[model samples]
Target chain A: MIFLSTLPGVRAVKNLRVLFMGEMQRLQRYHIIAASLVVAVIWIGVLHFTDVDDVTSIFPLLLFLDATSMSITLIGVSMFFEREEHTLKALFVSPITKGEYMISKIIGNIVSNLQTLVILYLYAWFFKEINLNIFLLVFYVIVISVFHSMIGFLLAYRSKSFTELLTGVLKYMFIFLIPVVLEQVGVITGDLLTNLMYALPTKAALLLLNSTTNGVETWEVLYGIAYLIGLSLLLSVVIRKGFEEFVAKESGI
Target chain B: MFKVENLHFTYPKNKEETIKGIDFEIREGEVFGLLGPSGVGKSTTQKILIKILQDFEGSITYKGKNLKDYGRDFYEEIGVGFEIPVHFSKLTAMENLQFFMKLYKNHEEPDELLKKLGLYEDRNKKVGEFSKGMKVRMNFVKALLNKPKMLFLDEPTAGLDPKNARIIKNLIREYRDQGGTVILTTHLMNDVEELCDRVAFMADGKIVEINSPKNLKLQHGDRKVEVEYEMGEKLESQMFSLDDLKEDEEFFRVVKNHRIITMHSKETTLDDIFIDITGGESSEES
Candidate 1:
């Protein structure tokens, strides 16, 4: 039933599995787990401060958890390892097309993000957000994780070096994470929030979470999901083309 | 199996062409060396041959068809072990092999390959902890996993220890013995000397010389042979031209009256011949 590769059985599937396995093990480190756990704790603390006491609100943080740190971290880490191992040369030599390789990477990231999503869902259970709507929640998690992974892929492709990719993501955070956090906090405090948050991906995922858990029928949730799928697809095309160009020009043997 | 004709390639921003009009052919079963010092277009040529560098001005015909027509499938028939190793550092050695093995239409057992390179014991360890030589061995294993018809090796032994390097060289030989073609690029004269059935020396993007390593050495070599022997309780030496020495009275006297110890042809090395033909002092790189 598994015919993932043109080659036959699970060759492509195996490669995908390996890519995911490697990335997951990297995130299994104490420091990485501690950092993510701390993020979860801070989200809980924020819920207490706001007194909204809605556990569903924290759903957006998973998107933030993956997009800001996990995907960005994985891509940066992969690039650094490629440089150190000099493995891109091997990839260049293989029969696998650049397009195929990039797809494998995206699929790998999505699979690995499953673990992160499960952890987030576990945290949501503590707040009475886990319910019969689990299937819808799963769909949301998959879509959002994929969307952020595409963003990270684009980010990594644009940066010339690993350090450069990291700094670029940090700069992107300046433009992205801060505004969404402020807008969410404003909404919690019943203050006027900037509509600029509408453009942020974090806001889209958060809106989806708010609607799914709280059963809100606001247009914001639909708009956010649509925005995420559209943006993720657009970014996938852009980054794939960008990566093709990068391989063509980068002269390292 | 492949023929590259009048190939010309230049990077977009560079004024100078990196590969200037070179022609070469690799028959079905032979080890062909692209010998040159660093930046002499060896890697550039490999990149072009492997279809990594396009916008080339000439034609590359594989089995009488345009390489462009084949697309990524062309890689299925060719196994390339780069001069550098490529793997996910966080993954184990077996994991790297297992991933690459799936990319090919055909396959072999990674366990057997790992054992061949003495990497089986460490197959489960993350590649991050592997030494440089171990990574090189794994790279070789990756290349062989598909059982390719043509192999491209760019200084495949640069970082390996002597024993491992010898094993790789032998594998290249065995691959050729099984009717595989090889393209090896390196400045290591010994590698070219030992493995190459034919070699082309490049400098600044043009092949200045091409021939069998033995022929190149012989053509440019000193025509004299150095003979060492003991005569009258003293070590003696004599130089003789290989052209005609069968009837030389002095040579006969030395061989007849003295005990011959060691005699070697005064042949120039492949590197010396490369320097002579390419007319450039080899720089430290490759």
Candidate 2:
């Protein structure tokens, strides 16, 4: 506790709990959490009809999509609501720091991602055959969601409208997430191309998620954990800078 | 509580400064009005004082400490009511107030404030369902929720019936009597005339005039009393210098020999003074 308090901004994190609770409440009020549940049911439907009774191979793929894409989309949608309602402008004048605001949103996004994970995992366990380490999956989902939430912040800061934010996410999906997903599904083939997949963060995410079943090597797990954690730290700094710029613009500086 | 000196700020995308070098002081416990037309930099200056915009070129000392020396804690001591709506549309009025109320160490009771503002019955209604006047009143309630030492109010009564506007004005007076400092920005000269203790008018990013509203009127008003009298089925009027009217025989003759239709001193309104000093068209809210 003392070490945590000694961190630069941690001691000044006032109203973080209230802000996080408010975020969660608004997510429910705006039907965002309901939408996540609907998406989770869709994932459950996909798993139910698959031919393979042992669902270990496909479980990680479902989580990878949820933890990465849903995380970004949820943050984007919530922020756009704030922008539309001008609630962000009100929050700007409160006692909460920018760090606290961003952390609350990230934590709120993690809750939604975790909900999807729990729903899908419960369905697979009760209705089908599955084997994986649940604790490790939870950890990987958190890390991946945090990284993508930062991406969401960047996209939201630059987007002028909700449609523009969706377009930016689509561009990101095409460039970074699609190729890695294609390689994972056996659509693209080659030793050189397969090795180059390591450059994409989504590949690292999939590797971490896939490691729960014990096929992935120890070094690959370490690399995935390190890569995602390190990239999240780097993006945090960029996201903070972007937040300052956004505040300036919104304040009519 | 704030003393700003030679303050200058430019937007990142603009080549010229929006708040050109200007100086002003907001004394504690007094309502200081920062009045101007559109594009005159008053809003930019208010944003700077609230710590929303940094990188300003000069110095601002709040309570004798540099404004930059303050951080997130600065917001704990100040509250701002923006001109536009700033609440979550989907949240109930009470919910919106409660969410912001908990963020401050010192907070007022939401129910009491809502009742005072005549919004108690609608506390459970969503803010998106509120009328414009209700939303404006809600903004006021939110600004006072923190019990802030200093308040920044932008058009506190912009959209309201006369009765509601008076209620807001009376509440402002009561808040001032309790020793709260306020920085008000509004184009409505009537509000300024009633509420402001001192006013500064900005023109082209510079403070062109600064004084009490009465003083500004005195400085810009005509120094003659216009008197109209009924004479032979017509009304005849004449202007007498206020300085000599008490002793002038002509003024006495006019008052005694004729039935005076109307007679009064010609004191200028703040609206006329605003236009005269700022050299801008009146953007006063109707």
Candidate 3:
């Protein structure tokens, strides 16, 4: 019978751990983790038949897509499901802060997404002999996952249903990922387009992933890290500030 | 204990205020019912008290400290049961309860609660598969999982069968007897009469009436007694002023000489009072 008021920080941390574990368990029970693994396996199967040179060029893009876009979509889908079931209202009354709840969701989603990325990376390493900078890949995974999770939260907050959320994700992909797609297909080139695209978080994430998998430029790596870190920090602040407002509405207050 | 003074609130999107300068105090270890019609700010007031809808205009003191001063720790001492079921549909009842139980600093054995509510056998079943009554019972179990000092129940027994509703009502009384306070908001007058120590009727964002159920009934009831008697192969009734019942010869004669079928004081019910005090226009869904 510990009094939560006596040690607020300790209580919050404990509740955060509980919430994170519960979220992860839900992910597993819903077979979301298995589905993600299947998607990774599908990617591996497709890449197994491709040319080695093509695999080198395409693998990083596929990994980046899984880390950022797929993570964002999965988070959005999970939130919409929770909203539909009214499960979040239970969380709203619990002895946990909005910050704690948001962090738990982000961390839980990141953990599951990272598992998929690891499986895909291992398969590529053993079969395709593709070696990437593990440190850079992990860094990009964390930064990109967090940034896109926040974006997912914002989208889910505005959406009223899963179909609407899917529409929002599609719109987000078209608007934000266009520059990255054009760059990947060799349709866009030069320092001007690259510098312009670096302003977008997606492009910055791709730059980091590309630098890790292909070859690296010192300045590009430095700029990509700095840009992604700054963007993630900004998104974190915005999401933390807006979380209460979003939850209040979602709770039917 | 909770004390609220001059509380005022207006939704940002609405031009008019929702809760306007309301005042009330809930004593420790008492069941306080806040009753009103729909759109009369009952839910808004509850939200403000629960710290969900902030930016209110007045002061609320819980345990002698301003509610605004409290953080997430405020929830540690209180349990809130929403009017609607709020469990994860895909998860079993036991899983949902276990997850929520871990979020609390103090946890209760949920199995006992589920058993008390007649849901023990279905604890491992997903909530989505449950009937509406079962879901309502699960919601109550979730609210009490933390062993809270105070409980805020919104329609706690709505959609429940009489037997299950009786179980919930008894549990609430047991909680109160064990020194827990409760703030209940519901339109079910029978529950209010059976459980509340005091009730406030809110309308147009103001508490128009506040008193114990017995006191309210006395204040509004007719001060007379009605007697029904079988006379000459027909049933007849008569009303006598309660103030002079002993002295009134006719009343005495009827009681002594007539074959009295039934007799009762003409007292108003809490339901009638609720309708009268709240203008009976808006539905009682709030």
Candidate 4:
């Protein structure tokens, strides 16, 4: 184990694990996990009362809503708690890099989203007729969660308060998320609008989640996968660069 | 352990430099105090030293290497105790300490530290439920948990009772005795006087004076002694130059012939020196 630490990349991984565990512990202790479970229960309520017997079609929709919107909101909530408590200052001075901090938070949010996935999937499997591939759903949920988590970081960096963060999330939902969601529910329809939805990360996220249940065009699936992954990587770079400024702001520079 | 030379820095939005060409050295295994009033750049200097605000136009070397050259690993060798409480309120004290402790390759035992700080019984209590003083003590423990070679403490005893403050000061002294370096920043001149081996007084974005506390007192103090003697119902006081004490027979005559109420050299206090050198209020919390 000591020799492994002497190799490159091992120490960061070790620190990442420590930070990830801390994140999870905070999520539980801060009642963030309980809050997430409560939201899961709400989604289960929506599933139980739906008219359809075979709820495979709506499973991805609920998961998509959870993974995308909840991912962003939950990450924002956790970060705002850290900010309010000034724990971020403590973490800043620790022997961990910003990348590790960011990735640990993203991974922690993924776990919360996955927990919701499991609860919802199990409910669908036992109580209703479902025909989706669970493994593919897990994979899609992870991707969607990661992309939105990065968006959470961006909004968090620019927000001055929890209220401000919620405002930013609302603006994002109106601009990126609500449009795609409206189109998915057949509220808006046009080739131009449909093509424009392809340009948003949220659209790619919903596409990836929807592909799990029904057969999507192969190119669309590839586009959705490539788009979200590519956008997440781009957002990661932007976040990493912006983190120094954020740290300076948080440090009261 | 650290040398800062001609350091100058301005916030991106500000027109004036916050740290204007300040120079100082923090000796290894010694407590160095950075004393100043509000907005005079003591914290800015510390932030620079700790690698928090790095966009500065000067040179700082940690252990003879450029501070810029050091990466995140630099934090492995140091710990910071913030002036404000910075712990997860919902988490237990032990949990907070353990989380931070695991980030370092080397660490002191948190249980022993909590016990020393009178916090062992409350280790499992959530930090949100802790008293303000308890939280302050917990910050000190978190700073020491990593067994860091250098400690950067900002108002470590700001919100503690005398007994708890004494515990923290003694632990700081013990840490120094055990070959740890400390950079202390506080408006509490008493803490500075008790713990600092050397102190720098800052004002207007510059280090105006830097020396040992004793030397500063001696330099800024009177070279005379005062004698207050009781003569019947009235108190008569006289001053004598300390340099000519051996040659002055009148001082001895008063000492022998009168009832002495008080007699002492007029060495100044750190609070007075802080005021004189920094041109700021004496020992007022910032």
Give me the candidate number with maximum DockQ.
4
1 or 2, greater by lDDT:
2
What are the root-mean-square deviations of the candidates from the true structure over C-alphas?
Answer: 3.8, 2.6, 2.1, 1.8
Candidate 1 per-residue lDDT, tens place, B151-255, comes to 887678888889999998988898889899988777688888899999988877888888999998889889877889997788989998877778678878888
lDDT of 2 by residue, B1-286 (tens): 9999999999888999888899999999999999888888888888889888888999999999999999777887988887778889889999999999988767999999999999999999999999999999999999899999999999988888999999999998999999999999887889999999999999888998889998888888998899999999999999999998889999999999999999988989998888888888757321
lDDT tens readout by residue for model 4, A1-253: 8788745499889989999999999899888899999999999999999999799888888887889888998889999999999999999998888889989999999999999999998898899988888898889888888999999999888899888999998888889888988998999898998998899888888888888888788898999999989989998988888878889768731
CA deviation > 4 Å runs, candidate 2: A1-14, B284-286
lDDT of 2 by residue, A1-253 (tens): 7576445466456467889999999999999999999999999999999999888899999999889889889999999998887788788898878888899999999999999999999999999999999999999999999999999999988899999999999988898888988998999899999899898899999999999986899999999999999999999988888789798667521
RMSD of 2: 2.6
What are the per-residue Cα lDDT tens digits for candidate 3 across A47-76?
887767335667678777788777788788
Specify the poorest-scoring 10-residue window by lDDT in model 3 chain A.
Answer: A1-10
Off by over 4 Å in 1: A1-53, A61-69, A112-114, A126-137, A187-206, A213-223, A249-253, B231-234, B281-286
TM-score of chain B of 2: 0.95
lDDT of 2 at B52: 81
Give the candidate number with the greatest TM-score. Answer: 4
Positional deviation of residue A135's Cα in model 1 after best superposition, in angstroms: 4.8
Per-residue error for B77 in candidate 4, Å, reads 1.1
Model 1 RMSD, rounded to 1 decimal: 3.8
lDDT of 4 by residue, B30-116 (tens): 999888888798777888888989899989999999999998788889889987889999999998998998988788999999999
User: Any idea how many clashes model 4 has?
Assistant: 0
